[model samples]
Target chain A: TQLLEQSPQFLSIQEGENLTVYCNSSSVFSSLQWYRQEPGEGPVLLVTVVTGGEVKKLKRLTFQFGDARKDSSLHITAAQPGDTGLYLCAGSVGTSGSRLTFGEGTQLTVNP
Target chain B: DAGITQSPRHKVTETGTPVTLRCHQTENHRYMYWYRQDPGHGLRLIHYSYGVKDTDKGEVSDGYSVSRSKTEDFLLTLESATSSQTSVYFCAIARGLAGGGETQYFGPGTRLLVL
Candidate 1:
């Protein structure tokens, strides 16, 4: 099984600050996905990166996949209090039916 | 918000008791998954179904079993609940895609407490 290791397990920042969370793995994956989960609710898919060195932006959030397909990162610009949540990175290998391997997650807290 | 719902949103039970959790989706997706979320452990897949009556175990499948009789419903059961099983459970549905690009929509999740 592939294992994803997330850095900065916990982060606390004031509103308007910027932060980046990293997800690293020794194994290569076909795709990498980012999800943000709020308290008391399940995770919601934020984005999927299928190509190496790919970068996608969602408003103030930016996601990037490593050129080696063994790492990914999520960067939030001008973070707001609403951005606080648990961020998870999942890697998928092989075909679509393959299961995803998830990282422990990064708990982000953007204080007002 | 993919029309997925989990029954018994909050459950409290004792050890050695049998417990069942239900996941129902209205989107008629082809795949469904059951996962458990624990502190510092992230979400670990327990079981997944690709089609009706076709199921497979995941990374953390011990002590749990799943059954799917219809495209919209997946059931997960714990034969004998244990304290280690206390955690929030989530159900997800996805329309399978190639190259593992499919996005999974999750339900609200069910919080289970085992005493």
Candidate 2:
């Protein structure tokens, strides 16, 4: 089983502060994705990095896939209260439609 | 926005009873998956299907069974409900859209409380 471990399980920061969440794994993946989930709602995909050392930026958020494809990072710039939610990273292995293994998640709390 | 919907958004059931959760999709995607999330366990895969009548066990397949009789529907059944089975259940679908982020879309989720 592929496991993705996330760090700083819980984060509390004031609005406008920047934050970065990490997802580490021992197994390689074909692609890595980032998602933001709010309470009572399903997760919404933020970005997907398919190539090793690939980087994708979505407005205020930047996503990076490690060169080895075994890890990834999500950096939120000028974090706002709207960013407070559960951040999860999922990795796709082999085929494009293969099952994705997700990280435990990082709960971000941006205090306004 | 994966056009996925999970029924029985919230349910409470007694132990040793059968419970089935339904996931419906309108996107016509070929892949569907079921997962459960706990406080510290993030989301763990229960089962998934690649095509109609083609299914496989996920990491946490024990005590759970799933069926995909049609391309649009997936059913997850709890053979015998247990308290430890209490968690938020999510149904996801893969779009595989070109240039679209290769991420899964989740349903609103079903909150099941087992006694």
Candidate 3:
């Protein structure tokens, strides 16, 4: 089974602070995706990185895929209260790439 | 936002009761999945279907069963509810097979509490 482990299970910061969440695994993946979930709602996809060392930016959030395809990271620049939520990383593995293994997730709270 | 909806948004039931949750999608995606989320466990797959009458177990499938009798409807059933089964269940649809880097769109989620 493919497993993704996330660091800093919980985080709280003042508005304007920068934070980085890490997702690591021993197994390689064909592609990786990041998701953000607010309370009482299902997760919303943030971005997907398909190539090693690829980086994608969405407004204030930047997502990076590991060079080895075994890890990924999400960085928030000048985080605001709106950025507060649970961030999750999921990887697509196996021969068919038909399944996604997700990380436990990091909860972020940006206080205004 | 991908035309996915789950019925009985919230349900509370006693132990040993049988419960079935319904997931309907208007996107007509070919792949559908059932996942349960809990505090400390991000999301664990319960079951997934590649097509009608074609279903398979997932990582945590022991207590749950699923059926896809049509293109747009997928149902998850709990034979005997237990308190340990309390969690937020989500249904997702993807246009193509997973692992191909296809984006999976999620529903609003159904909150189930087994008393």
Candidate 4:
């Protein structure tokens, strides 16, 4: 079984602060995805990174896949109250099918 | 946002009782997944269906069963409820074409409490 360990399980910051969460694993993945989930709702996909060293930006959020494909990071610039949520990273080994494994999750709270 | 809905959004049940959660999707997606989310555990896959009447167990499938009789509806059944099984359950649909790297859209989720 592959495990993805996420750092800084809990985070609290004032609005406009910048924060970065890291996801590390010993196993390599073909693709990695980031998801954000608000209270009382399921997770929503934020971005997907397929190649090593690839970076994708979504408004204030930026996601990067490691060069080894065994780790990833999510950076939030100028965080806002709406950026507060649980962030999850999932890794997929197979090129097809539904065999994705997810990290524990990073709970972020951005106070206005 | 994916047109997925789960019935009995919140449920309270006793131990040893059978419970069934229903997931309905209007997108007619070919893949559907069931996952459970806990405080420290983000989301653990319990089961998934690739097509009508075709399903498979996931990482945490013990004591849980799933059936997909039609394309739009997938059902998850807990044979005997256990306190350890109490968690938020989510239903997701894969919106990408066959093969991997597809984005999955999730339903609001069903919160279950077993006492």
User: Would you estimate the TM-scores of all the predictions?
Assistant: 0.96, 0.96, 0.96, 0.95
- Proportion of the native interface contacts kept in model 1: 0.74
Sorted into a CAPRI-style docking class, model 3 comes out as medium
The sequence of per-residue lDDT tens digits that candidate 2 reaches over residues A1-112 is 8899998799999999999999999999988888889999888888879889999889999999999999999999999998999999998886556788889999999999
Off by over 4 Å in 2: B99-101
- Per-residue accuracy of model 1 over A15-109 as CA lDDT, tens digit each: 99999999999999988889999999989999989899999999999999999999999999999999999999999886556688899999999
Flag clash pairs in model 4.
A95-B100, A96-B100
Error of 4 at A78 (Å): 1.1
lDDT of 4 by residue, A4-104 (tens): 99988999999999999999999999888899999998898888888899999999889999999999999999999999999999998866565778999
Model 1 lDDT per residue over B1-115, tens place: 7899999999999999999999999988888999999988899999999999999999889999999999989999999999999999999887555654676778999999999
lDDT of 2 by residue, B42-111 (tens): 9999999988998999989999999999999999999999999999999999877476445688899999
> Which should have the higher TM-score, number 3 or number 4?
3
lDDT of 1 at A24: 99
Every candidate's lDDT:
0.92, 0.91, 0.90, 0.92
- Among incorrect, acceptable, medium and high, the docking class of model 4 is medium
Which ranges in model 3 have alpha carbons more than 4 Å from their true place? Answer: A94-97, B96-100
lDDT of 4 by residue, B1-115 (tens): 8899999899999999999999999989999999999987789999999999999999999999999999999999999999999999999998863444676778999999999
lDDT of 3 by residue, B1-115 (tens): 7899998899999999999999999977888999999988889999999899999999999989999999999999999999999999999986543445576778999999999
Scoring the B chain of model 1 against the true B chain gives a TM-score of 0.95
Ten-residue stretch with the least lDDT total in model 1 chain A: A92-101
